[model samples]
Target chain A: MKLDRRKFLNMLLGIGGIGGIVSIIYPIVSFLNPPKSAEPKVNSLKAGLNSDFPENTSKILKFGRKPVILIKTGKDQYKALSASCTHLDCIVQYKQDTKQIWCACHNGLYDLNGRNVSGPPPKPLEEYDVKLIKEEIVVTKLG
Target chain B: MKKISNKLINWIDERYDLTPVRNLLQHKKVPMHRHSVWYYMGGVTLFLFMVQLFTGILLLLYYRPGEDSAFESVRFIVTEVKFGWLIRNVHSWSANLLVFFAFIHMFSVFFSKAYEKPRELTWVTGFIILVFTLAFGFSGYLLPWNELAFFATKVGTDIVGVLPLVGEPLKVLLRGGEDVTGATLSRFFGIHVAILPAIFSFFLALHLIFIQRQGMHEPEKFKNLPEEKKKYIPFFPDFALKDLLLWVVVFNILIFLALYFPWELGNKADAFAPAPKGIRPEWYFMFMFQSLKFLPPHLWFIEGELFGVIAFGLIGLVWMLIPYIKIKNRQNWKYQPLTILGVVAVVFIFIMTILGYIL
Candidate 1:
């Protein structure tokens, strides 16, 4: 191929422009992808003393950006699950009457084991491991 | 002083070959007609955006973004910093006015049929800019980290999650996780100040270049008039001065609003708290929010909110491509289909917006 001075310069400018644009875009794309810290690695949180948590009662505790529900199903038996509804991120409340998690925003229901039972929730609420260590209740996120 | 200024201009003109620019400014003309007032709408919007940039920067000097400090910083800004309340108020008021003027500018363009043929790209670019302006408002609304803003953001992002495939991921990306948190606040802060401004400026530059190249759109009546009968004024001194006068008038109104109705920094956001009653989106988004609220839970096979969203998307796509949609005047009707459609849209928006507030 016969390459003229104008054509060569044009090719160089085109490559230079592409290179410049890529250089600017690469950092931005990576920067916008949230860092690991953005989703805090909060694996376990103390949910107060097990003695204080009465039987058949639940309390919502802060777990990073989400809320985790700790339910005292029976004496020395506890369950922990994500409080955010899978449907729309509305915080779910533990219903003592139905013995299930309920989202008031859409009336979605989840079983005590975090299974989606009814009403628009496409997925189940996330389950967390509950442990009692030295009389203190601890909620650890499940993988 | 005039002699020195003329010499400086001549020196630069000789080196840079500024004749094209000089001719552009000197020879450009604005067509004068009944709809000439609408021409000032875009300029007013631009002026208000400038005000937003100014006051936003001033607020940023004291504003901090975090779950812990966002509300506190805003409180400090209004209560501690000198004239901070005024700056914050001006910023909030100017942001609303900018959106208001942009809507007027868009409607004026539509009714005047200014988006026809060669100006199609202008209309498209303007539409994109308006979208980004709303994004600006949405992102900025969360920066205060108040209860209203917190729940509003949640509800807004929830609506985004209602879409099918891309919706969930987009919602996660916007929120920076599974939920709206300090991470979301930081993300919105970056978007409101840096990302949005950079993108908005690029489109704005293109929009302005297109307008400058095309001059102002002449109404059909003005276009049909004979050259001898048609009226026009020089764009540089005559029309430009009028635009500046309007900007001055608008600036006074902005000051009046800021002084009389200061923007409030409500209660701080509490993640565990149940969403407060009567949670609503901003005024510009109220029409859509209200319409979505009116939808039944299930519309046929699809969820009602999802259906509403999809409908809005399709309608917006058609509206953006209005100039390209060719409809044959089969009946030779006096009123064009597009014009009638525009009127219907205006009426719908007005009624929906009012209902959004009152109901």
Candidate 2:
């Protein structure tokens, strides 16, 4: 029944362990019933200025909840395609070297026009309408 | 306080019968040798796992599981919530460390032939737990809903899609549809927090119970040494204290990592966004990821990816059945092909992971 040094230390360790466990569980219980958050929603977006995208380069711009890749093929010519690849929905890129929309995964290839050209992609990238209003480039969803 | 506690302990022991447990600890001994360091690996791995469980629970508090909110919620946690960044980083780093030491422990057991005797089920349970730990990493990676995580997960699932007959269905089931979507987020969340933890806990208990029942395996050389010359320490205080010391050292290292190298949050995932350059899996999975990249687009009649998946599956099977294989070959005991294979596998993993970073 005596309070030995070893017994006291064990009691201290047990208390610390309980404290540690409580600290962990508190956050999780709070998270499970989180307060509602206000989220911004958008349908159409002005990606950037026309000069932001140079010739033969690709720019990824957010439209609504997803991203659209705007490719400036030449001076005054631009094409917009949904960035999500058709194969597995990876964001596709404009490869300046290959002059094609390239997927690093599986080497899936799509032409500038969003048509599936090669590899495992079963469908083409979704085409989007691009308009240059004044100097700003705006991207909108296609029907 | 001492008298009250003693009485309470006595009351509980009268019902629960703590005598055998106390006696077992009193009698237990761990052999002391040059290779005694390997014995600590299991305890260290378990300590890291306990850390993971704590940090993971903290993370679950703030991680919103959905395509729309997943990324935002994670960002909010890291950038806004109090100590959220530390919790997340510790959780991630500890997950990596768990896998790291688990691999070391498994290899140590293999080399020591600790999996040879009645301890075969112990090895099996340990291996299953390792697999679940990797699965934990895979599922948790996507919870952040970052750009790299999204694409990497897509690629990972596509690898699963290469299985022969059940491939397509399994892929769909994992992704919760044709692709990684909102459904995929929900599925991964469920698996990471609920399913994987449950499976891991069950197997981990079995592994530990088996170890406790069988005791630490002495190497062949140690078994032949004269009993008078051998050294041992009681498991309760001596060995347990050493294990605690190692756990403390590991905790210090983990804190330093969590503070100095806070886990990076890449750009938010834009499902419609173009894939970024240099995307890769977590370092642990890099070996398999890099190996799959080396495969040709087509191998004979079957697709190259399918071939790679099948090869990896076969390798895993061989690894799981090593105890049986060794026992069957106990008669001849000529060349240790399994040991050689283990070394080769370790070398391959290192090379592939290094190459994954470089190429």
Candidate 3:
């Protein structure tokens, strides 16, 4: 059957509208459908020197793409805690005087060992295996 | 003989007295009110939306929203990818500006009574578009996996939990769990980058179509009403074209601001950070957040959170329902409480926003 002019135009407009919506939605759906966990390159992230980390202070160290907070307890001993807030994942700040990693965004506080102390933090800071290697602080991320 | 007929057909088509086309092509009249410059706020909003679309696409090239790759991908985009920081900033800053000017545009139209009579539907549709615009902001907040976005989403979605019966379910659906997690980020990403824009564009197109069909509203000013109002431009070649020119100017301003005061990317969200006191939202939202702060726990036998949910939901419903409110008697505008309340609400929001920043 031959389509009338108005009908054809309406059909085209309908097609365009549906197409626009689909075009907008398809990528977002794919993106939303559980992103493949980036192949973890997390093979023993290396951080800073144990002796260089000041007492009572936790330094934000880069271990690959992860944040490892390195705090000095003794001359050769260092503590490694993840700097991610357990609430909404805001960057947790390390206050030297308090000996705690704090998330200022939502009032989440964690002990130097990454245990949640108070406020809205639902989880403790994840700890990493930390050691001193020839004056360099080594951090291997643990659960 | 066929060639001759074809030439005749072409000639007739060309000379079909296409005066309608010629008139549209010619430059037409535009409103020359001194306050017409304020009209650029709407144009600014439109321009920023274009910027958002472009920059969002650029961001899409690298952003990973999920449990594992979210933080890592964000790091790569900011520090590793070439000019990725600029793309991220442009998108971020434009989103802020887009929401800002949309509010300004809505109120400008509201206060001027541009929503009266034939323009009522336009106002209503525009309001829906505004809602979706904010929803866009809310969803996009979690994508960066930073402290502010992370905790802010927690506080935000928790607010949804204050709704009476459906509250918990709403929160769960929004976050995709009992808490903000990889599921939450992915859900928000879907809404931000896809769903909200789809809804907004639909309403926005309808708004424009209504404006074109009914034409811009004439002033109710009896004595001071300008005679040239009736003689103004058509949407196709005149007003819409003017809007384009204004959009170009606004686009340049956005670029300048983006270049000069590039958006600061805060620290990537770490789930273990201590929450900050007086954690606030984007300035436009600060008023409502502040409003919630003002409510007492026992207001009308309910907690402040529940009260806030009902109050805001009511306000939104009234805004959407304003078009159908009939003021019968042929001429006098209805003294609807919603109007005064809307103005008060806008002013209150603005004042509270400033106060939030200060206090």
Candidate 4:
């Protein structure tokens, strides 16, 4: 079939428009998802020995891209939560005297259970599961 | 399918009038001539701006705006992230290209005397866009938070501080503190990503609307030619198709540059560290940088740096008010003060830029 001038131009425009959209979207998708090399491995990791984390003491450990607060309230009783505040992602520190997780930014607070107890935090700190394997203490994401 | 499409068109037309727009496109004509290639300069600049926008947003996703993380994050984006290298380099290169094309467009408009009468506001808006483009460049330069960028920003802000009374306040406002620290990074990042784009988009829309309302300006010679001697092409299909072809070509060039010369992630800035040697502004700012360097410490006890700054301000003022300065004259290009001044300014920029590199 022979294409007329209008039809030909319309076909060209349709093709160009599709190409234009695809060109734009490809970069955005690549940017958002990022390549595997760029993404930090955010899986479970060994925090330390159970003996290192004693009663009434808390320690901050690097867990992939975020900092995790590992606390031992009692013997063999371990709790782990992300140290980033839910409000602004600032690194939260454990106030030993208050026994609460505190974000210096905006005075945000989280309870021992990782719940947003007060201040500007809109959500609870992400909790992680802690387990003891022989002498090693391991932290993993909570499902 | 065709009938349903036609019915949908009819449905939309009932609510809003589309016929006038269709008619406008159908009847619109672009004058075709030897200098018609310059007309595509605006379209190319627009395309480059779009490229900058896309790559800019992509970079924004991964960019961390802080004194501590800014440099590291950009390094990670360029070196660690997949295709982050391409996105970043394309963004940088396109920014340079956008400024380059804008100058070409301004010159083409100047030589053709397209800014004459009726189109003065259009010219003003175009000038505003050019300024916005330069502002985008300056603000975005410091986002990388590298050694060169750090010193360059310090030098840039120092230049701003030379202004009479508002100098110190404006410097503080831009730097956000006593010096170029983390505060400066945050301020520049916000201005680069959010503030400048918002302001530039407003002027860009006005510039575009003016162009559409007035149509493309024909050179004086073309306008003076007999109607029967002139040639024209429809704006919708013919001219637009050519514009698309040029855009495709430009896209290829942009990608090629991005792939071949991936942008570098220089050393992270340390405020306490000594300013490194050979630090300079981007190529576009080299002229001003060189000019400032060329000045003596004092000229007859009056500060030479301050004198240079004042001179630059006066030149900028004259540039912005060119249309008003020549408001009485139109239709002739020979011996025009604006034209002569334009040529001299271009020459000054070229000479200074070369000297900036050499000296």
Better of 3 and 4 by lDDT: 4
Q: What is the clash count for each candidate, in the order shown?
A: 0, 6, 31, 0
**Could you tell me the lDDT of residue B45 within candidate 3?**
88
lDDT of each: 0.88, 0.85, 0.73, 0.82
Pitting candidate 1 against candidate 3, the one with the higher lDDT is 1
Tens digit per residue, CA lDDT, model 1, A53-118:
789888789897678888899899998988877766677788888898887655568899999897
lDDT tens readout by residue for model 4, B1-117: 999999998999899989878787998899999999999999999999999999999999999999889998999898899999999999999999999999999988988888878
Candidate 1 residue-wise lDDT, B124-172, digit = tens: 9999999999999999999999988987798789889899998878888
In candidate 3, which residue ranges exceed 4 Å CA deviation?
A1-143, B1-30, B222-242, B326-339
Error of 3 at A104 (Å): 6.1
Number of the candidate with higher DockQ, 3 or 4: 3
Model 3 accuracy (lDDT, Cα): 0.73
Clashing pairs in 2: A31-B61, A84-B272, A91-B274, A91-B275, A92-B274, A92-B275
Model 1 has a clash total of 0
lDDT of 3 at B310: 86
Task: Flag regions of model 2 displaced more than 4 Å.
Answer: A1-89, A105-143, B327-335
Instruction: Give the alpha carbon lDDT tens digit for every residue of A11-34 in model 4.
Output: 999999999999999987554332
| Predicted structure 2, TM vs. truth | 0.79
Best first by lDDT, ranked: 1, 2, 4, 3
- Which ten contiguous residues of candidate 2 chain B have the minimum total lDDT? B326-335
* Residue A105's lDDT in candidate 4: 33
> Which candidate leads the pack in DockQ?
1
